[model samples]
Target: MLKEFYPYEYARNVFAIDYKKLAQMGYTGLIFDVDNTLVHHGDDSTPKVDSFFAWLHKLGFKTILLSDNEKSRVERFNKNIRTQYICDAGKPDPKGFLKAVELLGEPKDKVVCIGDQIVTDIKGANNAGLASILVHFIRLPGEKHIGKRRYIEYFVMWTWKHRRKYRHRLGDILRSGK
Candidate 1:
């Protein structure tokens, strides 16, 4: 069960990922979690985010925003980025991930889901048999309390980092052609 929370890859941030390498790996689609994963929770897209999406499109990758947040929240964040989105996605459930794959018109193996939360984003991708990249969540200002789940996530991430067997790097995968 704990293994389900393990992501296929981990990155410091979305901008830190090598999309070109992923495209070379035959990954044609990307499903993203908007809040924290892309920007701080409830924050609007920045020029950096806009440019990133444009660069992704140029690399021939189809993208989608999949979030558990309400439609309006997702819509507001996606307004300038302009990607297809599924709001109120009920993630950690395979349904939303599978739906994103269908919407991307790509095979499950050809799609990768990127997000900050392990339980929701990584587990959902694992459950749906798609690849996943886990990014560290962006911390919001004045955010002192993170709740119980975050503590558990921290422990999980600690284990994932310290245990060599559990660590998977995207660069390593790309180099091995796996």
Candidate 2:
């Protein structure tokens, strides 16, 4: 049961991810969480994000935004990045993740999901049989429900960091295909 929440890889944030190496690993698709993963809650895309998306494209990745946010929020954030997206996605349910995989036309094993929350993003990707990359939230959300989830995420991350198995797993992921 506890294993269901465990992410396949963990990183500080999206910028820290080694996309080039992932490409070499035969990963062809990337599904990203919009809110805290790409930017702070309710914020628009930054120059860094713009460049990163371009870089992903140049590297031949099929990228898509899979967010739980409403269409307005997702649309606003996507104005500059301009990737395909599914708004108001019911994550932690695998449906959204599966849809994302279908959108990329990539096999389950060739796709990766990147997000800041385990309860939703990580679990959803795992349920969809995709590799999940757990990134720390760029900034904590101000919403009551999301803020509450942040606390639980902190505890889970704390425990995850303390475990020897997780340490080895993290090391392996970082060194994979290098």
- Tens-digit lDDT string for candidate 1 (6-58): 88788778877878889998889999999999999898989989889989999
Cα lDDT for residue 21, candidate 1: 86
Candidate 1 TM-score versus the reference: 0.91
Top candidate on TM-score is 1
Give candidate 2's root-mean-square deviation (CA, Å).
3.6
List runs of model 1 lying over 4 Å from the truth. Answer: 162-165, 169-178
- Model 2 lDDT vs. the true structure? 0.85
**What would the per-residue lDDT of candidate 2 be over residues 1-178, giving only the tens digit for each residue?**
5667778778888877788788988889999999889899899999989999999999999999999999999999999899999998999999999999999998988998999999999989878888888998875555445577888777877777776674434234454332
Give me the runs in candidate 2 sitting further than 4 Å from their true place: 140-146, 162-178
